[model samples]
Target: MIETRILTADDWRTWRELRLAALTEAPDAFGARLADWQGDGDREERWRARLAIPGSHNITAVLDGRPAGMVSGVPGPRGDTAELISLWVGPEARGRGVGDHLIQEVERWALRCGVGVLRLAVAPGNTHAGALYRRHGFAATDEPGDEMASGEREIIMVKYLTAEDRTARDVTAGDLSGGCAPPADSAGCAPRADPVPGG
Candidate 1:
């Protein structure tokens, strides 16, 4: 059976291991390089700091007692939006609905937090990953975001979810408008890893 759970500050060891694995296996998927974080005495500190974010939640998936995937979400500056950051699924677990499962958990977490919108960034050339997002209710936005350090152009996608008038399919992956980072006075989605992370 596959299992998934939200991460807390105490999950630092697992977080550090999985994050490093993600960076090592899919270097281009993240803005931060594995080398940048590896071997640092403060890596543990970084993991704790990230977990300490009050508005953030991290989900980790396990299959047969091994880590399979992870996804993180943090509240948008607007308080009504949530951004999915740093998603990654291990190679052996790709086709088992792990990605969908991870996203669903984020949705549940977002709804409870009163998030009205959900957003993520996709690297320009990954068609398969883009299709997956579209299937789940994410649509492309022409949002202007800084080019990732990997030289990949990013396309922002959004889903809108509200407590009322939400549909089964719609609620699965829902709402967004024109992208281009929220306005000067607005809070935009935070830096996310790759579009699919490593999907």
Candidate 2:
């Protein structure tokens, strides 16, 4: 079974491990280069600062108590929308529904934050990841993402959530992390933070 949990400030160690692994293994998958975070004297302190930012939510997925994957979503310009990012599944755990569970959990968090629209950026050549996003109801939009160091560009995809969809998930605002909490007025509330720290 896949188990998902929000990453609190104390979980920085685990976050760093998985994140570095992702960056090393899939250098082309994210905006930040491995060099950007390779050897930082204040990495831990930086991570703590990241966690304290309100509306920033990072999550990890585990299988049998071992970290398997991660994904995150944070409120967008309007609280009714969010940008999903930092999706990564370890090599050993791919194709085992790890990604699915992560996406589901992020979606749940988004909904509780009053997010009705979810968006993501995926590189065109990354077919597997694109397929996964499509399976979860994402579709391409005209928006363009900045050029990557790898020279590949990003394509935007979006998904819309409806009232009926919110009803399907039994999550309430009270049970959510303060980091993932919706604004005082969730509707059209400005985005205060990102799901991932740097990107």
Each candidate structure's TM-score, on Cα atoms with residue i matched to residue i, is: 0.79, 0.88
lDDT of 2 by residue, 88-131 (tens): 99999999999888787777777767778998888777889999
Lowest lDDT 10-mer window, candidate 1? 174-183
The deviation in Å at residue 95 for candidate 1 is 0.2
The candidate maximizing TM-score is 2
Candidate RMSDs in order = 7.6, 2.9
Question: Which lDDT value does model 1 have at 77?
Answer: 57
Residue-wise C-alpha lDDT for candidate 1, range 1-199, written one tens digit per residue: 6787667888878877888888888877666677776676346677777765655667798988888998888766566777877788888988898888888777766665556798887777766667778887998887875477767777889988855623332432323111212223222334333232222
Model 2 regions more than 4 Å off: 172-178, 182-190, 193-197
